[model samples]
Target: MLKTAILVSAMGAGLMVATVASAADAALGQKTFETTCVACHGAKGVSVVPIYPNLAGQKEQYLVEQLKAFHDGTRVNPIMQPMAAALSDADIANVAAYLSSLKPE
Candidate 1:
């Protein structure tokens, strides 16, 4: 019985670690941003264009919510709607994580 308890505890801990690992990956986010967001948002989440918002150092939850809104058509924008539509939920989370990690200029 003690052995079974230990095994179950170990399995639970492994699952928790896996969950944490899968929650967000900033490196993956950077790759996606390079391919998708570099044009408007610049190299490090600072937008080159005056109209585009700077994403660096923004709150992660806010970024995630806005992106989801754009993806769902709740926050309509001609450019961002389509751009955000291409991202999955995981991609949004990762991107938000990456952007939030940056220091705003």
Candidate 2:
């Protein structure tokens, strides 16, 4: 029983760490956007160009999926593919979180 209790505690701790590691940091996302995405996506995710889709207030999961697709070559866009190629999974999550958190204009 004592061993079982210890095992459960260890499992809980591990799960917590995993959750924290996977959680997106919106602050980091904003910085990345400013440096990498602001040119096309805009500061608050509203695109100034009619051709660029506005990202503000979009569903976080959808953004993540699309970004992943772009990164993986499943989605083809000459511009997006190259831009997304540099983003890691965590960066993608962060960017999605930041964009989704915005209120669209």
Candidate 3:
């Protein structure tokens, strides 16, 4: 019984560590946006060109899935494929969070 409790506690702590390790930091995301995405998708995730989609006010999960698609090569856009390739999963999440947090202008 005591061993079961100890094992459960250890598992819970491991899960917590994994969760924190995977968490995204939006501050880092802002830098990433300026460096990589702001050209096509503007500073606030709006696109000046009609061909480009505006990302401001997009849902976080939707943005994450789109990034995943690009990263996985499931979606094919020359710019996005390369950009996504360079991003880690946390980067994708952070960027998604940043975009979603923005108000549409």
Which of the numbered candidates is closest to the native, going by highest TM-score?
A: 2
lDDT of each: 0.91, 0.92, 0.87
| lDDT (tens digit, per residue) of candidate 1 on 1-105 | 999999999999999856753589898989898999989998799988999989999988789899999999999999999999999988998998899999999
Q: Candidate 2 — which pairs collide? A: none
Candidate 2 per-residue lDDT, tens place, 16-89, comes to 85685459999999999899999998779999999998999998889999999999999999999999999999
TM of each candidate vs. truth: 0.79, 0.79, 0.76
Best by lDDT: 2
Off by over 4 Å in 1: 1-22
Which residue pairs in candidate 3 collide? Answer: none
**What are the clashing pairs of model 1?**
none
Candidate 3 stretches with Cα past 4 Å from truth are: 1-22
Rank the models by lDDT, top first. 2, 1, 3
